[model samples]
Structure formats: C-alpha cells, structure tokens
Target: MGKLIVHPDYQGNGIGTALLKEIEKDNSGLRQELFTSDQSLRNLRLYKRLGFVQFKIKPLSKDLNLVFMEKKPGLLEI
Candidate 1:
C-alpha cells in the first residue's frame, strides 16, 4: 500500500483504520509495507497501532527522514 491521507475535516473518525483494514483484507496472507515521513507522528502512531513495525529509517536531509514500516502475513487480523 502507498500513502494514505484522510481529510482533516474527517480526522479522528475511523476512516484511516477502516482503509487499512480493507487493504489488509484484500491482501490477506501477504506481507505489507509502507513508508511515511518521520515528522508525521500521527501517521506513525496509526501504523504502529495496526501492527506495522519500523524496519528502516532513511534520512533525506537534516530535517527529514523516511520511516519504513511493515506488517508480516497473518500478524494482526482486524
């Protein structure tokens, strides 16, 4: 899966979680991965909450970094 962005007006609803769950359902039994900016704390939290773990951190610049995260197959089913 790629980037996931829920509209700010709809923030705090279960949109992001639901979207991730759907992706998980579609790709059942397959490993999933994604990356997001280190500064995006909310995104990081959401991904972690859904069973993704940080596997890498690549620095883009002094103030920016990419956090790569992944979830193993059958790890956490919604």
Candidate 2:
C-alpha cells in the first residue's frame, strides 16, 4: 500500500484506516514498510497505533527527513 490518501475533508472518518486494513488483509502474513515525511506527526501516530515501528529516519535534505516504519502483525517474535 503506497499512500493511503483520504481527502482533507474526509479526514478523521476512518477512511485511511479502512484502506490500510484491506491491503493488510491482502498481504496477510507479510511485513509491510512505508515512509512518511518527518513533519507529518498525525500520520506517524496513526502508523504507530497500527503497530508499525520506526526503524530509521533518513535525512532527505537540510530540513526534511523520511520516517521509515514497518509492521508485521502476524509475526509472533520481537
């Protein structure tokens, strides 16, 4: 799942979460990875709540960085 985009007007309506869930169902038992801009705190929080862990942060430039997160809900090990 690339970018789960819900228009600004649809924000807070669970649309993005639903989309992510569907993709997760399709991928069933695989680990998924995605990146968001460092400044997007809202998205970061949502991803974290969905069980994604921030494994690294890549600096894109002097003022921008990418937050790389991953999730493997089916995995039983830490």
Candidate 3:
C-alpha cells in the first residue's frame, strides 16, 4: 500500500525504480500487491520484471480495465 509518483519532468531517470527498491528493501517477507490500468503497458512490464504476476483483472468501465498484480518476494505461495 504505497504510492510512487515522479513529476512528468523528472521521469525516466530511475526515480520509480529507486522508490520501489527502497520500499521493497524495508518491507520484505510479505506479499505486495498493486493495481493499475491495463493500458499502462510500461507499468505492466516493469511489475513483471520485478516479479509480480497477474492475480486478476476486473472491468472498471466500458473503455478501461484494471489489472491486479502481486509479488511474494522470496515467500511461498498459499
């Protein structure tokens, strides 16, 4: 449950990666989940590379879909 946002003028400089790394560093051994629009392909790829897998997808509106993803780090899946 965290938010990471870098101003449009400051993007593409690894700010988002740094933020996620720091958060994941202080919070290990627990499953982490996040939600984003299906249209966010960049975010989808980033999450996948970070070990998150699609947990579910639910319709948000007639023109958009929401994607739910989760990562367990080094923990076992129940």
RMSD of each: 1.6, 2.7, 3.5
**Candidate 3 global lDDT:** 0.81
With candidate 2 superimposed using the best TM-score fit, by how many Å does residue 7's alpha carbon deviate from the native?
0.8
Which tens-of-lDDT digit does each residue in 1-78 have in candidate 2? 456678999988888778877888899888899999999988988888778889999999999999999997674322
**Which pairs of residues clash in candidate 2, taking residues 3 or more apart in a chain or in different chains?**
none
| Model 1 weakest lDDT span, ten residues long | 69-78
* Per-model TM-score versus the true fold: 0.92, 0.87, 0.85
Residue pairs with colliding backbones in model 3 are none
lDDT of 1 at 34: 94
Badly placed stretches (over 4 Å) of model 1 are none
| Candidate 1 lDDT tens digits, 1-78 | 446789999978999999999998899989999999999999999999999999999999999999999999968633
lDDT of 3 by residue, 1-78 (tens): 566677889877888777777777888977789988999887887778777899999998998999999988794332
